[model samples]
Target chain A: MSGSDRTASLSYDRTGDVRMSSSRVVSLIARREILTRLKDKGFIASSIFIIVLIMGSVVFQVLIQSGASNVTVGLTGAPQGLSAAIQEQADIFGLDAEVIEYDDESAARAAVQGEEIDAAVIDGNSVLVSESLDDTLGAAINGAVNGLALARRLVDEGVDPTILQPVSLDVTALQPAADDAEEVGEKALVAFVSILLLYTLLIFFGQFIAQGVVEEKASRVIEVLLAAVRPWQLLAGKIIGLGVLALAQLVLICAAGLGGAIAFDILTVPGAAIATVVQVLGWFLLGFTLVAALFAVCGALVSRQEDLQSVLLPMTLILVAALVLAITAGQNPDGSLARVTSFVPVLSTMVMPIRVATGSVAWWEIALSVALMVLAIVVVVRIGGRIYAGALLGKGGRVKIKDALAAERVS
Target chain B: MLEFDGLRKSYGANVVLDEVSFTVAPGQMYGFCGSNGAGKTTTMRIAMGLARADAGEVRWQQRPIDLEVRRRIGYMPEERGLYPKMPVAEQLEYFARLHGMNSAAARCSATDLLDGMGLGKRSKDALEKLSLGNQQRVQLAAALVSNPDVLILDEPFSGLDPTGVDALAANLAERRSRGVPVLFSSHQLDLVERLCDAVGILAGGTIVASGTVAQLREREANRQLRVVIPGSDGHWARELGYAHVDSAQDGVVLLQLDDPSRDQDVLSAAMAAGSVAQFGWRQPTLVEMFREAVAA
Candidate 1:
């Protein structure tokens, strides 16, 4: 719209214009923050680093898992059917075993000592080894040898050995475990990943927002901004802008991690992983808003960048505590500490996500925790906004929160 | 028209502004003159809605200035500030948008303002890359980018070189011609004397004196006269009984008149003594008026 048309309308409908202009101001500020930060080398580097870290971890795990499952077994003068039997038994045990024939026991022993093969089976009656054998490989070799012996006995008794097929009884529990071992492991992984991502992002974005607020104050840009719009608008714009950036980075990292895990067949349950991502993202919004508001207040409390660390210490400690609680929740998701702290606002941002991921939290618990966090966010934002406005124009090294609140009342 | 009607502000037990009242009518350039800690910045902040006035309001066209009107007012705070990492042109555009201009209009305004300030080539450069003088110009451009209806700048001319000052003066003059009311605070009295149509002298949290320059001068000027008698002793006015000599140097005597109506009589008395070369009522400059106002 033309400047004249806008100005005319501004005066023509005062009440309506106020509502429209505030949002416009906030968006303008938010856009500036986004554009400016996009050019920052630090922002780009951190984002790239996180994505590579996530993908790299997944690839490394896949390699380790593949390498761990492979086994090479050496044989010396073993029966023809024995190699095939060993291969079939190893397959049942989920091991990829390769049996290689040797001219004699000495050669097989020498191969095992050289570490080329994991172990050796010498004659049909005896199983050979270097140092010791793993239980899975031992069981596979034992089962093969016993079956061969039993068949020989049947032949000696003039019975049909081909009809002597092996059988095992089917055992079932009335009520199985809620989560299988693999599912529990998957959930634990989700808990760890979600917590780590949330912790790193919350801290990164919290500092970004705080430093941003201080940058304005130190540069004295707040004066010009406050002239056109209210302090709350500036605060809101900064939080929303940085919050979106933080959320985007979180999503990118989660998606890359999830995609990599699935591609490499690392994650058994993809749905749970996706749900964890959603929960982390949802909690992150509330968490960032809560912490970002306080960070802004802390930033306003100081007039210089050098003083930021001291003022930020308390909030940083709180975040660190949450991080610790989140890790503990991952290990003991149903523990009393995790359960109780999952309802606390700042701590819940971390603990609740882990609890949810690990399947220890009920739907009502999540809802109540979310509601409490939302309430805390509302109160924190309101108070923080006041303190921010009060201390924004204040000059000096440090301002007490009490003084800022008092100043806010006067203003 | 912008009116700051009885704006009062206080910090703790100390009052920074006490019923500080003044107005800049349309097309008028009002100069705010005060010593250090005289509440000039505070008054301007209140008008811009950057600070709250405890007991009064800043009204425009007899209406209290709300967010809409505040966005329309161009304000440059005493503390000069802009995003140092932001490109100069983009920073100005952001400010324009904050003042309620749409993106396209804001862009146009920012580009034009930057070019007008001779910063066209450097518009793409970060603000911090510019010299302090150039940065100051960019700050001014930010204030003017929205083509504001009212202008309130605190210490706008401080630290500017002569060329920069002239550039700013011209910009302000153009705005004044376009029916915009401008209020700027400055320690530079001579520039204020030459530029502002009305002047307000604030001291001890109050406007001690404020009016048109001529009106203030007239009010503060003592009933004194200066007469140059080339061939007579300078004690002629004292001997005439209607006036007494205030000072005398270089054959010209400065007289403190006992009455305003006796000026012609004194002139006749000077003619009776010798040939009169020069005679006029002595008026004080703005600096003198300010010193006296603050001192009082």
Candidate 2:
């Protein structure tokens, strides 16, 4: 088929040219709401003021990192000349190691017991010992003590100390997988960022849709506009318009806040996290459209703003439950509950990113979650749009959900 | 021009409009007069495309009124709506934008309309902060801000003082002069009688009496016009074959003219008699006509 012919076949005729609808009404709606919201003192001032707070928090976290735990080593015997080298290793490991002079081995043991030092290192002829049951600590000390003992043996065997030490073994990790420390740090950073973005977006855009609906209903302005636009179209406009607004704010914060950290090397995220960012963004859009649409519908059902929280409280509880499940997913991305909710529309927006960050899930699961979310958004738009249209015109009375449904069914 | 064709709507079992049909022509001021539950509100809502009718359609010209048609139609609902917290200018601009004006144009037109309404500087004031009269004035401005081609206002003059009433009367007349069709519903029968070229009286979801005010007045054959003059009024009445002289006040004798057209002879005779003064026509008011319609 020709390109035009294929498109013609693909696109069905809706009451009017649905194609032309985007720029025609959508632009007007977006421009009106965005301009008014941008002029709002809350949006403008908080956007500026919040970033300063976040930047301050970042600085405080970095400062706290500087005062890491300092430990002391009580060494019983330092096989001649190894003391200085062992001290270098301790400093490299980001710990403070002080060699304490002990008159007897019992005194060194007492020092470790009395908490005067972190550990007591007693040098036997070939073995090394620490007081606690920590074998790794004993091993680490032994490695340092043995290197010094080897140097002493070489000198005693008539080899020059400098010549014997000519060959040096610089310890290196054998496998890249052993670098779980950096990986864990990277995963923790991703988790924090994802959760922050998810919660902020939900709150920001949810309020936008909810409050916009309340405004329209309150002024009874909706009665006039319902004459022109279809119910769904109006609801869709507010959701999409404010969705664009919240997205713009997110991009701004992400650019300045996360962007600065990534660029400065204070934070590092995985390549998968990058891909997950894009996926998470899609889910963000989907989840928000669904949530915001539902809130708009709820807002219309109520006559006043005071009743908003009562309706919203239940929805908030659902979100909290989903977030809890999302955290559970982050810790174990492949667990049954995590895997299932990760692909579920409501929970996936918060869960899927962490899953992608920590676990190797099948690519199809990501696609399925997105597909399900898209479906959820469509359903919300249809159902919520109908309810909004029906409920919007009912003034001075509660908008009965049953009545709205009945009206839709009858029409 | 907006036209409702056999429009029918009901709430539960109560029919608000049953096959109601009417045409509001361009540049003519039409009044909708009805008692409570007389389907006046429902008809106007249907005409404005705000409510759905079970059976017929509301058409602009021949086709059903679409969004484009709706945009060109201004409606002031009965409840006196203005965003209580929104500033006057912002509220007006929002409605204007919904009617297809861009933000800048909407703001400009809204500002100009507010200034013309004598609410210029108060445009920044919240709607609730304004006095009730001024708030109503802003509501009127909201309806007019879009410069709609057809205006449908429900009870647009109910709570207004004389000045407010005059403003509505003059504004509607101005719009009519500019070739806009204006139809409004009101219980103030006197105002409706004075302002409308055509009046439709509805009762029980149907138009009971409709046509020009003159036609409705002419339909009330039982009502008679009384003409009066001073001195020789009794003799003049006898000459004109009048049944009786009703009364006299301020040297003006009341003569019951069975025919409203037989006034010229009385006028000439009164001049011949002495000092003829009270010469005018009084059509029966809509309150009387409404009572007649409701009875039917």
Candidate 3:
């Protein structure tokens, strides 16, 4: 016999009993789950891919927005004073307009037709545009041109243009909405990204927990696992472990995106951006727990991987529906449908975050939504744990969900 | 000691186990044998707490088994289960941890058990990479890794080769000698006869016969005599009015004596017919005892 053989034989003689702690066992199981998943190449590759995608998208959005802000126009037979007036008007309207002096009317018209300039002003009178102008751009250009024409008319009438100019009136409004239009735009972007991240993370990690449960069942390792820990402990440990992994990946992606945006000057306030990330994360935990518990139950309903699709279809459809509702809510944040769904459990995970971003949802509504989600999670975990304990030991083909629910717990 | 007390279970209207009961004393090896769907697996499963019994309980040392006590018992289900993707050593160690062994102890125990099973060299290999028999050995190693106080193995020898059987039997004997009560179900009566101190034969969801090998064989002794007469036709024993002729072949006749005290009458009859070479009472084998129990 080898040394190990001798040791093995001696083990039977050695009768020291080790104490078992339920929490310790749960932690160990959780550690095993985390370690195994972290080592999976598929998980690592997907996480890195999502991070890169988020960062790349932020950079692309910044480039497009910056490009859209600047407008180039051609001028022909225009007064030097008119050029300065256009510059001043453009600055007031927050437009970056560059004037290119053309030698004659044909040059300015050709420039507008060739797309070199957005529009053209020929002889400080008629504006030339190949296509119809946007409202904001037209208003700014028409105002500038009309102001210069008025000044020229005043000079011809033997009155000084400066004396004819009306006294500027500066009226300050007392109250403003919490955020400006630009801030609201930024919030909408943040909310959209957050919702997308939540949807992706919930679906991916929910399936992950389900797959893990099915793997243990298929391999028959669940038998041994249940002997040591209660079914609820196992389920809780799996959800927590996978939830942590999903959160880590989510944080990485969000940080990369927001960091990229900040670096490119697209997002001005880091504090607000971080707050949004935190809020999304908080909702993610609630949504993930509810969905993941249900997933574990779904997984226990089948023993084979091939049968997983049938068992998991309803939950998948629910997730997809939630995502669709959230996206529609994103479109009209203050709509009645968005307001109603924001208080629902699964839909709220997606809707409330967007409402928090785009609309001024009252604090009480946020509280009610979170409370409802917690209630749903509690109910789901209770039912899911029971099903998991009952159906985990069943063998043969897929177990009927009704039968699993009716079956008695072994422990 | 491990006691299964009147475990009754049913799935819907189908009763899988009906008032099944047995006991395995300390240091005793109990062999559980049954026909297909005779509730052998169900009984073991209930004992291991993998399935709930409609009534009855599994007691360890006169106390009902709970999670704390269950952790000290080793169980191998009829359906062999091991994570195919996990390395053999890690899988065993994980099971040890589930059984309440600390990480370092689990590692050591897994290493030792694998080495004892002659799978030390293949410990690093994924379970799927090993041959079927080696995988079975690893499953057995997993059961032994916890150094359990009680063992409930459901068909541990179903798919093993001769060497695998011997190794498992030896390890089980070692555990038994160390005062651990071992209960395992198997169809191999020969191995069971050689290894088990007591045997329980189940039929129709109940134990039909259960006792030591000799005790069961003694219970089955019906005072049948095997008579070998040289140069005599097989019909002579039938002509002597022995109503139950168990078998007759090649001048040898096995007869169940209607009156055991009248054995001399049949013996004299055989002597008058021809020279009697051998005449003696027959001892039943375990296989014969099992068949009789099942048949009854």
Candidate 4:
């Protein structure tokens, strides 16, 4: 037989049994999604921008903390005993103060302007400052200068300076000590960063899923894809693929922030901070799955990219509401509202992580929140998959969500 | 053999396909023709498993075609879709992998298909960068990359130029020579008539007429006769007393004879009037047959 004739007969055998494993097909689709987005210049550039912002925040926090450690006072025409009195007061307040004497008030003013000293004790009793001092530092300087002026006045009035010396009063509080207060501040910062990360990641990646779906539908590629794989597989694969990308970007930004904090010695108790990060990452997976599924469904409802915004409005609103609630809840982690929201399914993904990072949340609450999130994810996936399969191949204008839900499943 | 049997589908109260059925044997090219909304696309979509039919099944070699079976069938949708931002070869390879080919095999197949489509140099170019015709070629290559057992294309010739049409025809011919059953829909009836082994004409969601191209022409010509005589305006056909006269022009008359046995009398009358140049019956073109099928 001729070559063509032989090949014709050979094709009969080729038709028998050529099926791929399900997971393999899903991975192939997932890989395509990842590669396509990774190659996109916009995705890459935005990822880098976020990392820089994270690192920048870390650096800013470090600079503010280090600047708080020292107080320098430039002196002009101060009394002979004033310097010793100021030193005594500084010791009492646990402040490190450096005294520099200049020739005149003008020189002291110049020194303050040049940042040679934080404040200047000009003409003995008047305090010259370039800007407003924080309450604690201002109080320390006022206390020292006032005490010396009182002593000098008593001596001039022919009264004994010892008799006029004020008694030292000590006060104690039931609240946490200074170090504990600093720890509280750090915890709040951690929670704030955690919420910010969750909000941005969820929003960014959620939109990624939506835009990806619209691209497929708008380009008419969904038909070809629907032929090869089940609708659920395509939906799940896209979510998982973009989820992986989002997680990678999140990890990089978080690592950059953590590394910056360590390098600048800004973060104390690094182990605890790292634990908070790990918890945030865990909650991110739940939050991402819940939102990504809805995004896909919304994406399928619109054939044009411009129509996506209207269809996605409800999802965007929900995410924004979650974020606002989470931020308000972060301020009072142990409050009743925060505690209540922590167990709510969609809200928990945003609230529970912040509460866990900042306060001593009960283990049962965290477990319950996670369970609720998982349940929500399951429900969303079922409904979202149906809508996606129903509306994906629909052409011309936008498909109504109600119609899509009512339409029969394609598969 | 690929068989689309008793397919029925409806959107809301409007029926898109009602009892649309056809079969294509291995190594044969079947042409599916229809006007807009005649269920040509719906039927192909059902066969590819992209859409579910309300009632009916697509079977391959006596087994119902499912996801696994669809993976082995190449399908080009009516509205061609590919990732505009994806590189040509990469997208094809991606599709091949989705169809169950190994990564290495997919890569090789993608390159081979692109090279065959005269897109070898543009393999790395994004799909959007290519001209519309080249993009269409890439879409076709994507369908063929898996070396599918059957090929189903909807309007594969729609946006193609003559050269593109020729290239696509050559590729499809090669597949057909390998015993691959190819079913495609097109409005270009001449191309369908020339290339297809069998033709199915759909109207109002039903298969109005279907058979081999020759068979359909012969069936349509059975009742119709075209008579031509030299030096006559073809007015002699009016004297035959046929109930229907299709047309008369250029000294030739096309008639639908109520009694075909009367053809001899008609021929004698024409000969008596003038020397007969062409008196044999004429075969209807695919376009003519499509109109007649849809009209009926």
* DockQ winner: 3
Expressed as tens digits, the lDDT of each residue in A291-348 for candidate 3 is 8899999999888888988888998888888888888887888899999999999989
Residue by residue across A204-296, what tens digits does model 1's lDDT show?
888888899999999999888887778899899998899788888888888878887888777868887777778778888889899989888
How does residue A160 of candidate 2 score in lDDT? Answer: 76
DockQ of each candidate relative to the true complex: 0.44, 0.26, 0.45, 0.35
Residue pairs in collision within model 2: none
lDDT at A255, model 4: 84
Of 1 and 2, the candidate ranking higher by TM-score: 1
- Name the candidate, 2 or 3, with the larger TM-score value: 3
lDDT of each model, Cα atoms only?
Answer: 0.84, 0.71, 0.83, 0.83
Q: Compared with the true structure, what per-residue lDDT tens digits does model 3 show for residues B1-296?
A: 79989999898899888888889999999999988899998887777777889899989999999988888888888888878888899889888888877778888888888887778899988899999988888888878888888998989998998877877877787778788899999999988998998999998778999989888877766568889997676677888775478888888988987778888888888898788999887888778888888888
Of 1 and 4, which scores higher on lDDT? Answer: 1
Model 1 C-alpha lDDT per residue in residues B1-296, reported as the tens digit of each score: 78888888898899999998888899999999999999999898888777788888889998899877888888888999998898999889888777777677778777777777778899999999999988988888888888888999999999899988887887788777778899999999999999999999999999999999999988956667889987666877668766778787777898887787788888898888888999888888899899989999
Q: Pick by TM-score: which candidate is best?
A: 1
So what's the TM-score on candidate 2?
0.77
Worst 10 residues of 1 chain B by lDDT: B231-240
Q: Candidate 4 on B125-162: residue-level lDDT in tens?
A: 99999999899888888888888989999999999998
DockQ category of candidate 1: acceptable
- The TM-scores, one per candidate, come to 0.89, 0.77, 0.88, 0.86
Ranking under DockQ, best-scoring first? Answer: 3, 1, 4, 2
Per-model C-alpha RMSD: 4.8, 10.1, 4.5, 5.2
Interface RMSD of each: 6.9, 15.6, 2.7, 5.0
